[model samples]
Target: MSSRQRLFTLMYRVGFAPWDGHPLPQALRDLVEGSAALPAGTALDLGCGTGDSSIYLAKHGWTVTGVDFVAKPLDRARAKAATARVVVEFERADVTRLSTEAVGSNFDLIVDSGCLHGMSAEDRDAYVREVAAVAAPQARLLIVAFIPGSSFGVPGIEPDEVKQRFARDWTLLSSGDETAMNHNGKNPARQYLFQRAV
Candidate 1:
């Protein structure tokens, strides 16, 4: 296992991953419920800790797949899906190196609640490539990440980076405020909407 995977595993095993229990942010829910971009189709939830977001999508008639690297959280995610009576395919996957073999060939919608910010610049580029590879035509990418901030050690991804990385293939639809909290208070989140080029 990669050291990054080990770190996340330890975080989950020792109860340091507090984001595991957060409910779907209201803004995200509103966007998903109101936007035409996300219809009832296949959904991929990256960093789907405990499968809450996956379960949410499955319950809404979307065939959902939740991917995380840690087995402990994936087990919990599976249990949650079982209890919720929703079928969310839970897989152990590294976000930095996602492939069609690991996550399937095409997904209609992809949601990254907190993973993209956590990735390094190189990993983020890999992530963009993987997203481009797997996204279906007219697919939508919804990202909730912390904008650059004073929170030391937290992944503070810049909006310009996201734009520059995805400029070729994705058209930014909009960006707005969010209340989702990371390790820090309030998180100062920015929810971005993107559509794959036709």
Candidate 2:
């Protein structure tokens, strides 16, 4: 297993996951409602914790792939998808290095749920590049992340950082505060909608 995968495996083994795995976030649930309008092509869920988002997409008739670095969550994700009666291919993958070889390419939609903010600058840029690699031109991306200032120091990312990183290849369509349930007494966040530039 990769080092990052080992670390996250330890985190899960030690019962230290900081995010909720029970209910689907409001932002995600809302997104699913529009699945009809989305391309029936592939949809990817980055850092798909326990497979909820992937299952939702599969249920809506989209081909879904859920990727995460940790094996533990990916295992749970598979189980949950089975329980939900939806087929979601869960792969243990590092988003920063996600490749066409592993998950295929030209995805029609991508969703990032609290994944981008915690990455290092290099990995964040790498994530954007990988997204571009897998995404079809004009594909849609939705990001929900812990906005800067919701908490103090380390692992938080500002809106500008995201915009600047994706600016070269993506056009920001909208952004706003998100109401996804926060684990620690109202962890403030925002969501951004973008379309890949032609």
Candidate 3:
């Protein structure tokens, strides 16, 4: 089995995955809902865990496609969408090798919630190129992950790195750091948002 498949299988066996959080992250919901002038178009949710954001986006009228490397999580994501009565296409594919054709052409909006952090440097570079290639002009890309000063295993990617990776094809619209405190007030996290250039 592929590494991604193994990862998913392990996650399912452990009964927990980064993308399978309950209640979802408020930061993401707020980001999507508050973005005034959000065009109704195709949206891609990369590494969509349990399909929370995917289902939410679909409910808001965006045709959503969620991609994940793990089949176990994709299964859960699809079930979540079905239960929510939201139509979301969930596919198991490695983001590093993701093709535009697999996503049905370019996407108008792409959201990556905690996927980039897990990638090695080489994979991250490939991911950046793949994303740039598939993102439509002026597409909005929202990313949420642990930043510097966090205990997350993945090293934090600086804003400069983000720009270096995407600026050739994307523009940094706005970015900020948020301390995402959960119910227990522990396991704080960080997030970032950007927009593709026209």
Tens-digit per-residue lDDT, 112-188, candidate 2: 87788777777887898999989988898989887766754337688888888889999998887676655665757
TM values, all candidates: 0.91, 0.88, 0.85
Q: Measured by TM-score, how close is model 2 to the native structure?
A: 0.88
Task: Score candidate 2 by lDDT.
Answer: 0.80
- Sorting all predicted structures by TM-score, with the top scorer first, yields 1, 2, 3
Ranking by lDDT: 1, 2, 3
Model 2, position 129: C-alpha lDDT score: 90
Tens-digit per-residue lDDT, 9-90, candidate 1: 8888898886767668655586568665256898889889898889988988999888998899899999989999999999
Better model by TM-score, 2 or 3? 2
Quality of model 1 by C-alpha lDDT: 0.81
Provide the lowest-lDDT 10-residue window in model 3. 179-188
In model 2, what is the error at residue 180, expressed in angstroms?
Answer: 2.7
- By lDDT, who's the top model here? 1
Residue 145 local lDDT, model 3: 63
After superposition on all CA atoms, how large is the RMSD of candidate 1?
2.3
Candidate 1 vs 2: which has more lDDT: 1
